[model samples]
Target: MSNLERDPQEIRCGTEAGERSEVLAGREVPLGGPRAMKVSRTLPNVHRRMIGAWCFVDAYGPEVAAMRVPPHPHTGLQTVSWLVEGEVLHRDSLGSLQRVRPGQLNLMTAGRGISHSEESREEVLHGVQLWVALPGDRRHVEPGFEHHADLPVVSRPGFTATVVMGAFGGALSPATTHSPLVAAQLAVDGPAEIPLDPAYEHGLLLLDGEVEPLTAGPLLYLPPGRDALRLSGRGRVLLIGGEPFGEEIVMWWNFVGRSHDEIAAFRKEWMEGEGFGVVEGFDGTPLPAPALPTTRLKPRGRAR
Candidate 1:
């Protein structure tokens, strides 16, 4: 299973079984930064699909001001930051500091936890910040860093695909993970359609331009076991989903785990001086406490 290419069918099967909640596009939150940049929180406190093992997605900007934020800390997670327009510099305590421009991707695995900061260069910044939950088995591993520049993008007869993680269209990212997950960027001019594995469930984020959802608007969820999906008009899409975890995942605030008690213990440790790691030369930005759910009950009905 380690070296064999995953059958898209098997992947799709796992996706359906792990099906939970769909993303309801929410209002944009203005992040007061270099230029009062705004952030759209797509899927939170719910299940995320279309990319392998990943459960969260957020798109940052086509910013006019250079946005810079002080370094912060994170643990038991891997952050995939992809620049879409400008350049952003990342510095960490692990002696890893680099500037990433458009088309470059920075993959930071905060195993056992680590602290870091990202800031815009001369002008402004625009990018996507993706958070992928780490399997329980690998959460305590040592931290690591990987960088890819001008990754060989795949452009077939009808679509353009950029594989940021896992394998897609015969291309893959260097970063390894405990689960099978694929993140791809698809751009289409006019109408184009691609076959979907009956097993894999997926979602599309209209990052820029405009796209017509073949199914319908105000979409709640796209089901599994389908032949293919088509997209038309002039626009771009961020396709994310993957095989779902067979077990339940407890997500509180920014922490994801199998046990709420386990996350609570980690949070307690983080609040004290017992940090897992620190970002070198980084002016640590205090992490806001995660907002607890209003009620313990989960929302019923399809995504709206």
Candidate 2:
């Protein structure tokens, strides 16, 4: 029997109810290219505040872009860049330069601060960039880097799951964080249900093909509640969640934090040109200015 064919009640799951929702809305920003732009379509918190500590989710570069962003600064948050297709070269002020392709995960914990930039080498670069809000106590800690070459990749029946952070089933990632979170990807087809825990908040992005609740349009945010969810139809899906971050978090552009003042200060520093303080070991150039939005931060109301 396929792993997905097993009992849905017993399958290990995240804390969020495994429910599906329709892709309701999306916001797209043309990132200099006529076609290549930043799309904030997924993530329930995209237009608002944090849903369980996950903030500032962006999916870009399914198309070609002539321009690539240079080195930029970041502070008070952990930045994650995962590729689904194409390539991205990341250089930081700390002198770390890494070329990441698909199946590779780049996690930067800017505890105290750091500066970095992702430049696409080819015409097309597509992937997801997530900004995870750090706890106040760990916000100003030292910076670090964790890259996995032989990370565990598990396949079960209709799906393949990647353990990028925290733990999943019996496998676990080496990366450490203050919260209990799991980053996963699912590639599947036909009708199937994914069982999840009731304690964790969850969200899913349909990378290709289509599914109920989440059409191949935008990101779907699933609130915490039930223990299992069934995704019918076919295609591939990327799921990420864990214990819902209970803290109230705020997000503005690429910055995420628990307090508005902290975000404001980050803006002041960013405007003043103070990016995340890079590590001392990586081989790279200094940080550059961020690709700021054309307008100030918009109020997206409350998290659902």
Which residue runs does candidate 2 get wrong by more than 4 Å? 1-24, 32-36, 44-48, 258-261, 271-275, 278-304
Give one digit per residue, the lDDT tens place, for model 2 in 14-35. Answer: 1232244434355655553344
Per-candidate Cα lDDT values, in order, are: 0.59, 0.59
Give each model's clash number. Answer: 19, 17
TM-score of each: 0.78, 0.78
What C-alpha RMSD separates each model from the true structure? 7.8, 9.3
Residue 159 shift from truth in candidate 2, angstroms: 1.6
Q: What lDDT tens digits, residue by residue, belong to model 1 across residues 1-304?
A: 0001111111110223334435455435555443557766554423333244555555666667655565455666788887778887788768898888777778888777676677665555556777776776887789888788856588765678787777677777676766776677777677777545555556666766766663212223445666467777766667665554443455444455555466666667666746656556655554434433334422121122
